[model samples]
Target chain A: MLRSGPSVILFLAWRGLRQYGLSSIVAAFSIALAGGLFLSTWKIKTETEKAFRVYDGGFDAVLGVRGSKVDLVLNSIFHVSNGPDKPLTQEQYENLKNNRAVKEAIPLSGGDNYKGFRMVGTIRKLFEDHEWRPGRKYELAAGELFADDRQEAVFGAFVARKLKIRVGDVIQPYHGLDFTGEDSVHPNDFVVTGVLEPTGTPADHVVWIPIEGALNMPGHAEGLGFAPSSVLIKFQPKAKREYLQLLYYYRNHPELMMPDILMTIAPLFEKFKAFEFALTAIAALVALTAAGVILATLRSAMNEKRREIAILRSLGARRATVTASILAHAGLITLLGIIGAFAIFAGIGSFAADYIREEVGVIIELFEYDPIFLQVSAGMLAIGLLSGLLPAIQAYRSDVAQNLTPTS
Target chain B: MAFLEIANLRKSFPSPEGGELPVVEVKEFTMQAGDQLALRGTSGSGKTTFLHLIAGILKPDAGAIHIDGECISEFHEARRDLMRANSIGYVFQSFNLLQGYTCLENLLLPMAFAGEANQERAEELLEQVGLDHRMGHYPRQLSIGQQQRVAVARALVNEPKLVLADEPTGNLDPSSAAQALELLRKLCVDTKAALLLVSHDQALVDSFDQNLDWRDLNAAFEQATGTS
Candidate 1:
């Protein structure tokens, strides 16, 4: 015999909830769907930001044709840029490489694909002299880097597995940017010479080759010397001490004005803030719908609950006890919903990990114990209790004398 | 001071005709501790209304209800609620047992409000009601007679001073009703709690130690036509 009115209320409320098992499950499931959506969206945002930060390669700036700075960084670094601007001339690349403030400049050019994988044309220094990530240089899993200007290709880990091309195998390049093109440039059989180790970055899906071969390709834009799609510059450590001076000089210099040197990483993140805000609004709407479902379920079930509540009153329950019981019922439903939502999140994270990695190069880390999850759960509990307010008030005002008599 | 006392008690509800519809009017009534009384009346003749007024479930329009020397009608709603929980036990016509709880759980329900009830004593009361064998059975699994017996056990769980039963055996067959009535009366006596039962059955009324007709106790009815 659990004494105290509140204990009795809890016991009775639990019994009542169990009596309508199907309705209880439906209420909990609605909340679970909302919670799961909210959690996954947050997870995606966290992982995407982490990926962007990690892949910045410690570079200070990007220089490209006067256009979207985001597109310049995307094209030069990740091979996902959709810019229509013409490639920069070799004279511009040399001019940037010779700048006193510049420590290194890596040239990039690409408009072709090999069997659904983007073909990147760059110098051997991109592999040997540059760090693909801070303190981490590019290493081959098998064979060597492309040393000859002949049409030899180096496959990323995913591309090699996708195309099943070994070191001695030959493949043809498609002329267009999109990978699904049917027009293969004949007599341009590129041989696979190397396969790089997985770096968990966008490079896992590209095919690397010497820039000279890409420049000599028949359909490529004719230039005075080697042309590049963009330039990735690593500034001298001294530039940080004179950041304002360098910023003004880069933004105003005439020779560097045809193409712009953009402090792009910071601005790109500003755009992501808008995307994050939209996702948060979507999560809020889902939670609102879930709250509505819980409220409607309780209100609809109040009819059956009237008799039960009256019986409790007749047994000497105070109005507060009755109200507490109703709130307790709602709290229990939402608590179960939160538990189910976590399970659903884990299940979906596991199921979508490979696909997300393949499409966007972000690993969906499952079961990463985070305090934000606890905060989300607490917020949902509050929502559940708030949803119960109307029904609890109704229970408190129940007519014990009338509802006691058996209804005809 | 009486174990239960009422003076000039009156209660009414609003009629559809936009006037007060008098439900109960009793000039005086009293019951001593451990006494058994039967209130017999037709349906809608204010029998249950009087019971509600005495139990503090409804407020009297103009009167005082004193139980154990304290006038309960003067208490606030929450105080009345607490008094009812601690001192009064009700057994309804339909047995009103919560559906999912077992016989033992139903017996322990009042204790949850009134505070610590001896579990051993609850089991003993269930045995006294001839339900020792059905302690684990749910309400729906028991016969009407068995359920009423469980209700009787539950009413005595808090060891209240007064037990109000309204047509407790109304839905039982005659034999089951007799058995249920016997168990209810026995438990009330054993627990030393006064029992007040309302019923329309003359035969049932005849079994009690004292019986009063509703028309005899209703002052408003007597005055309306001057015929009591």
Candidate 2:
């Protein structure tokens, strides 16, 4: 018998599906809806996890007053805390800096804001020594870093865009970090010396200043040179033993125990693991349900196409040909769904990127074409194949003679 | 050897009374290449079953059927499918054109199964059937006569050695039916393909080279039903 190749089969399948336009469209979009949800959730989880891993401001550990370690990581690394955590004294900061395992220790003093943007008091080391991500140092978009003792401030990219702050603009700092408009405004205005390019980190919304500027705020005067909000520490890679010893010594030391304990970022990431697993599980369930939808739609379509299958069989198509045609029909629809899902994700990313970055501290790069997406495409294709399996078998087993005869 | 041959062919189906009912019992039949025969039978006389068995669409319970030097009855299902695809053209009573396909696509459908399609030849056949202008029209868009003409065109597209016209004009009106029958016979003769036309119309049977009364040939039909 004459044997038709895959191209012919595909062409015929395409023609057949196109004839049933509404059902084909409905089936395709149902898969797309599931695929889109999976893609969005997967993308958000990946980006957020990446952001969390690097959000620590290049510090290995945080030294703060005894409190929730998760809160300390949240406040010190991400700068997102409801209320102030107790501070580390100047002596504690000096001890941390003097530790042999601590390669660099920088003081972070907060409790001030400029229109809801956090006013973080840090030293020159923050701009010069920190890497937002590995090997990526802070690059100024405009102006220079702040001096050691001055009212000058450096704006993060988002803060500048939101408040229209630029180099040479002066903004009054509020005495407290709240944005209720009731917080007393500081007497001195802080001049903007620089604006940093977007680092895709929480620093993008912070106003950086010399530690002394935070100290000199009206209520903070008495606490000047005595206490700091937290001390961020970077450990020497070769001094692991010394680092562990120092951490153990500090946590157990009677004099330094109350308000100067160290909290590493490892525990915070552990907590995030559970939350991300739940999100991924939900997304997988959505994909599975989508597969079910594909199966049901194809199986139902098989009943309608029984006569068509018989015609093909009568024309010399083997059972395999009919089966392959059904599979091809399903594969094409699923592939279209995947393409549609990507387009939808791109639209969502374009529309919600800035908002996601601002709120979730994770940047959404639309259609980055991650290698993992190849795996996702395969998963979708597998679903397509599986969903079409029963129907293909049904087509294979169709009673050709019965279907070919005209109904009375 | 005859171009088309059948001997001791037998087929049966299970009856509602829980017994085997013999449907076809043909002792011998032969037709030369390019010969045309009109077969007439009652509704339940197994006329369609004979066509189906000859086409290798159904395996006869006991028989030897040969077409174009191939013993199709002995062939495996797949080989039979291939033989049918390569050697036989069937024109069904209802036209049986797939709904979504254009007339040209319908004509080319068999070629797709054969893994070879000749678009120029298909167009020529369409032109021969007076349907060149309607090649792009869907089956549903055509008149019943026009659809039958397309079916006729489809039947000859593969240039098979045997063409089965199963009541090819059954669905058409009188004028259209006459036109369809004439077109089917003319095209079968033009292509040098043997034709077996099944119909209930005696006047149509007179147009063919031979007239076959199916009930008289099927001994099993009378024995099973006792309807001499």
Candidate 3:
């Protein structure tokens, strides 16, 4: 027995939940699963969007051969795969470097791998001039940068840690993106010159060599004359007019394609909108079904406890008291389920953040506060209380005299 | 004025055949403070219905049930519930102790509804009923006689001015029934509470200071039996 009205209601509600323990647990678990799925999906969608929006890998655009802008950005900016097959000629590279609109242009050539890690060919200016983020220059953890016209390589942090390579060790480059067999290994053995510190960017997964070494490698097209895969360009600040003019100039050029990094990645998220909607719809359906289960379970428990409820009324409990007790029961279950949902979300969100960082090279902050957490919890709690309304009404309207009839 | 009073009390339930089946219709009844009365009636004789009416568990179609000058029948349902909780104690025949609560919790429940739940008073009542040792036991864990004792303790926990017992010993053996009746009568005398007991057992009714038969008390019962 309790003293206050609310305490009595809460006590009775807690006892009622304990009375039907298994059904209560099953209902709460269903709510947890639905909530976890919704939270995970929503977090992934929002965080992925944020990651792409803020991703500026030192350069503003990629000038490459006429083809898919998305592929060019993926290969040149994110190091996702081997560079494009059609390479930009030395004349095109020199023209872009000498353009007044372009502040700097670094050439990138990639068609080979050292044990599945992409090996990119670029000049020393890449390490000397580029800052991945504002005021954040790449620094070496060991040794020094590779010199031009040498069969030497500088490994990214991830590549060095993964392959266990040191400054003095040498590696044989494989001719293609994937390592098929020993026969695919090139005769060119590049010594490890340095290992870059972790940058938390896609560059952390690359191995860099000189442009001359990549262009002059054996079995390469020698007479085509210094054709790198693509040129990464940085535009001067406040050069929006010149940038748009260059974009328009390249739009009509049959042999060239210039893609702003942000513009190329923004449309990809638009394509994902449909998939996100489908996932949200499935989560909403599951939530509705969970609410239904709460209703059914409580209604059945109410029916079983009719006699007990009548006994309460006989002992001077008001109709409002009994009704509130039922609603409180629903509230308890919903609160427990919401707590469990948070735990489940943490597990799933952490796993997803790790997967995305490792596979896509985009960092997602797992613990960032979002308003969806509050909205989903409050919404589910309201639905749970609403689900208990019918049974509460039934309890309120029960016939005390009839139910309390002497069974003896 | 009497501690308990009833006049022109009428109650009816919907019959299976679509009309009204009269249950209780008493023209007049009265009891003094602390007076003990036994009401005897066979099955379906409106005995339990009369008890329900006085306890305010069921509303009468027409009546003035003045318990300690409150005229509870004229009050709203919520007020009647409060009136019952504060002034009238009820002991059911089957010992309707809540299965989920312990013996002490059962006693404390009524006091809680009355808004003055006192743990000490509940524990003292359990001691008076000789159930002090069983205070922590649920109804299922107690014997029938012990369960009845707990019910008696629960009814008196609020120290109401009146008690309504509907065959309180109906489930007990003869020896246990005698002992339970003795304890109930002694407790009522000690608390200065009027007792209105409804039972069909003549041997049980014979010991009361005053007794009334349902046919003599309830005009509706007599009319239903064609003996009015």
- Judging by TM-score against the true structure, name the best candidate: 3
DockQ of each: 0.47, 0.53, 0.49
The full ranking of all candidates by DockQ, starting with the best, is: 2, 3, 1
Candidate 1 residue-wise lDDT at B173: 97
lDDT of 1 at B3: 90
Better of 1 and 2 by TM-score: 2
Candidate 3: where is the Cα deviation over 4 Å?
A140-144, A148-155, A158-172, A179-197, A209-226, B223-228
Could you give the DockQ of candidate 3?
A: 0.49
Model 2 lDDT tens row, A36-143: 766776676566555565456677777777666666667767777743456677877898889899898888888888888788888988889877568988889999
The TM-score values for the models, in the order shown, are 0.81, 0.91, 0.92
* Tens digit of per-residue lDDT, candidate 1, span A298-321: 787778889878887888878888
List model 3 lDDT by residue over A206-247, tens digit each: 899998888788877778678899999999777778777887
lDDT score at residue A18, model 1, on the 0-100 scale = 86
Best by the DockQ measure: 2
Give one digit per residue, the lDDT tens place, for model 1 in B1-228.
889999999987777778887767899999999999998877767778788888888889999999999999999888887788789888889989987788998878778777755678778888888889899889999988888888888888888899999998899999999988888888788789999999989889988869998778986654333344
